[model samples]
Target: MPRTQVTGRTGPRRALTVLLPLLLATGTPLSVGVPASAAEPGAVRLPVMPSRLAAGASCTSASHEVATATPWEQRSLELPKVWPSGSGAGVKVAVVDTGVSQQARALAGRVTAVGGATADQDCVGHGSFVAGLIAAAPVKGVHFAGVAQQAAILAVRGTDDRGVATDTTVAGGIRAAVDAGARIIEVSPALADRSRTLTAAVSYAAGHDALIVAAAVPDATTTTMSTDTPPRSYWPADEAGVLSVVAVDAEGQAPQGSPAPRHADLAAPGAGVIGIGPGGTGHFIGSGASLAAGYVAGMAALVRAADPELTAAETANRLTTTAYPADVPRLDPYAALTSVPDTATHGEKPAEEAVRLPEQHTDAGTTRRALLVAGGGGALLLLVVWASAVVPRGRARGWRAAARNRPTGTS
Candidate 1:
């Protein structure tokens, strides 16, 4: 049987006017796939993992292929620069999706199920994949790692065993995550229908100071309804207090067939992204706005860990406002962690005072280069000033000397 595609709205809507040029200017390569020959001998090539299984399909198997090349998303996000401030330690991020597997190696000893054992079991592997994106630890040889490596994952079931989700399940997941004291809640599935239950659940989470991050659009699959469907809002994401995230490719373009949301707070790398699956030392490839939401949730954990004093709303504001500005602002983990919030431009009321974070550890080479540039600029300015002052005086003195030499005889 063909795998069931997780789908809702379809068709791309908006172009990333400035994001593509910014990415290209940085010269970060845009490919996520590592060729089979690039892998160690005897390592199998990674396969595309399914978001959901067809009615009676077998469970997702362990992948033996390990991605050795650094994923483009990792390079683009520049997570290493942000880690010096915090690695998301002490932050509990709730993954409300198909469920996270405890068997995933990278996430070992960090996952806690919310309701029951079912929430810890991942038959479809989608939740585990999402979880890995958020908090997977660094492995010896693999180049892939999660955003907040020290963060903990709270696994909650927003979808059934086969990875099908409904309004009720997702709403319940939010409430459960909030009640469990998860600071950051990531909702993976994007439903087409808007439910009062989901809205209230989001409000409940907000009231409890839980940051809810959700997918702005659904995952694209072969089973998606149609490519011509008009863009519309997705639930939970469209709700207030929820951070709606859209997925962009390496080139900052939305993946084909993945409809753009009417409104998205941030954009993240989601297309052709690589991550670990349930019970795998190897990796799997997945895509969509849902994956993008996972990235945002991880970054939120980092922010919360670094500055526990910031309210959930404040944390969200920091992430969005500090992002690389574009149609939908691109997620900049380093900026979110390091940049001071400017309440004026955000139009939000100022806090008691601007909370300044400690100085971040930057690359020595980069710092040295910056200092050199500053020194050079200062020297150039001094030269310009000296020339401006001396040239005029010298010209005036030469004119006076010529007049003196003329001895009152010249016209």
Candidate 2:
């Protein structure tokens, strides 16, 4: 798939202008700053989830690396299922987050920094943690490498230590990954609303047959009992053409009882998950849906590796349909690639065909001709789905805004 540039302000001033009054009327902060909007008391915040990779002591002769031999090895992490042979070895998984530490032993030769966005330096160790979870190499003592150590990674820094991400930077990172030919895009950060730039960027990536995965809102009741505000909703997850993932415990249980939306595609091991830390020294117990999303992304790489012809949507559906629901369905990596139905299909209940071609063509560029031709149809279909949800709500809000500004005095 060819890369296309996405343009447009994510949060328009007019909409925010109108929404601000209502927010203030409800006793919420309406300040013109992002932090202020985020800092409002009881305002729900996205979980600072990290996909901890390798953090345990290395047993290798190498000094900085963890000692390969340790008691942790005996009791260390185990793959939920056997790593599928010939799974996602050559495919690339793009990590869109804080940034990665290029010096880490497991990812030394595998990390590619997106120019102008973030170098291989990770100030807060967040990006490195996410990267390790997706494709960390096997340590001499540590038995479990990541889900796909053979997969390459493109690290696009979307946030820093302070935990902030602007839509513009994130959108640029998405376009950069698609332009560079990324097969699976892992977006750990969540946007607050369905902004134009984010929605378009997702469509643009999906048009190119790139699978986009992101974190869902955290389980409010399970972890924290904050009631100052309503439970937060995650964007990109809520948007069309993207798969939203929620986290589950080691026992394969969702964090909260909150039912996932129709868009909630899959669940992965999330709570108390361990992975590599900065400098490749030791491991840490990370929590939240971020790691779960990474696990799904790695599994997605394997799906793409197994069948290069499968579209992103198809890959997602395979994962979703085959997922084992522990109450809610959790991703089952092996079943996604190998499972097939045993029934006839003359006019039976049509199995949910995952890949639907696009309906319109917007000139992203000419370089990705093969991708454009094959994936454009599916891309257009996703666009229609996106429009159905966004356009009507926008028109209704516009009318409401106009009414709010109209002169009320009798003429």
Candidate 3:
């Protein structure tokens, strides 16, 4: 899908503005996705939150080198293959979390903070890290690349420097992000309860064809007290139209000791991820469902940049339908970018093959069948050659035996 179509909200979007407020008072306060036990009941954010390697690391240079940076997450997301089509240029992605720093190297010239939280400042650092994962400009030789390098970041600070914010504040942040022309809004916080204002904000964003990606489901085994309360589930993500992302580790399996994400609409690498820090060229390491959500948002931006005509829901459907693993449809940016069906042939009823995944991104079945065909052909050729050589040898041996027995007396 190339960036040719103009996107506008569908008919249902007009109704969301009317229908959203009704939901405001209906939902309860279980909006925090982070297990209260794992993280204090604060900003409802990603589950794969990373720990700081060095809180006091210096950032005196133009580009900071995080020696302990892990590129595995980027590789697993297959970013290298996805960059050529579009680096999310012309798409606005809102990072509605802690404020993003104006001075960060990766986002130096590309960030704009909306509303009145902190102007381009991520003192808590979570928002900066998440922003880096989404759109950090590539620095050669540093092994650093964001999912959508050219995507601009609209930093909407819903949380404070302590990584804490009231639901109302976060909800306002969401609304501001929508007004800032964000095509994709990445809400990184979880809440202990649903805020009607927040739900309304999310609804408002959807009304504009803006896709909201959030991590709303907590692991089933996540607990608050020793009494074993269920894992946290939050708003926006739990809301009707949001795309919920779940965290997977380097192995693409459930992270150790964490509860399995049962309600996740998709999964991504969230553990041990490295991201850009707010102050300098340095970096911070944290993993959580937030990282995965950010990655999905960045990918969504790519889809928008590649084809701006797709509606938010259609965009989301494309993501889920085109994702790999078939079962979970894990985010696959390359396939999403290159697997566009020809518009001339894309009518109401098109051939399945014509609309199917790009040949380069075929499933394992295709490769396995190819291997089987090649192996069968090789085995048949080997059998034919063996028969040709062995039959003649057997005949000659038989003739020699007969001559040895009869010719001695006859001669």
Task: Give one clash count per candidate, in the order shown.
Answer: 0, 28, 19
C-alpha RMSD by candidate, in order:
12.1, 26.8, 15.9
Q: What digit string (tens of lDDT, one per residue) describes model 1 on residues 1-411?
A: 111123333322122212222222232222234322223355444566677777887788788778888887898899878777889999999999998999999999999999532634799898999999999999998888999999999999998888888999999888888888899999999999998898899989989999999998888765442365666789889898899999887667777667757788899988768899899698877777889899999999999998887889999999998998777888999989988655464456765856543447356776788789999999999999999988898897874643445556567
The list of candidate 1 runs beyond 4 A from truth reads 1-44, 116-120, 341-411
lDDT (Cα, tens digit) per residue for candidate 2, span 299-332: 7887778777677877887788887754446677
Runs in model 2 lying further than 4 Å from the true structure: 1-81, 218-225, 228-232, 256-263, 340-411
TM-score of 3: 0.66
- Could you say which candidate leads in lDDT? 1
Ranking by TM-score: 1, 3, 2
The number of clashing residue pairs in model 1 is 0
TM-score of 2: 0.62
User: Would you give me the overall lDDT of model 2?
Assistant: 0.61
The Cα local distance difference test for each model comes to: 0.80, 0.61, 0.66
Top-TM-score candidate index: 1
Where does the lowest 10-residue lDDT sum fall in candidate 3?
A: 27-36
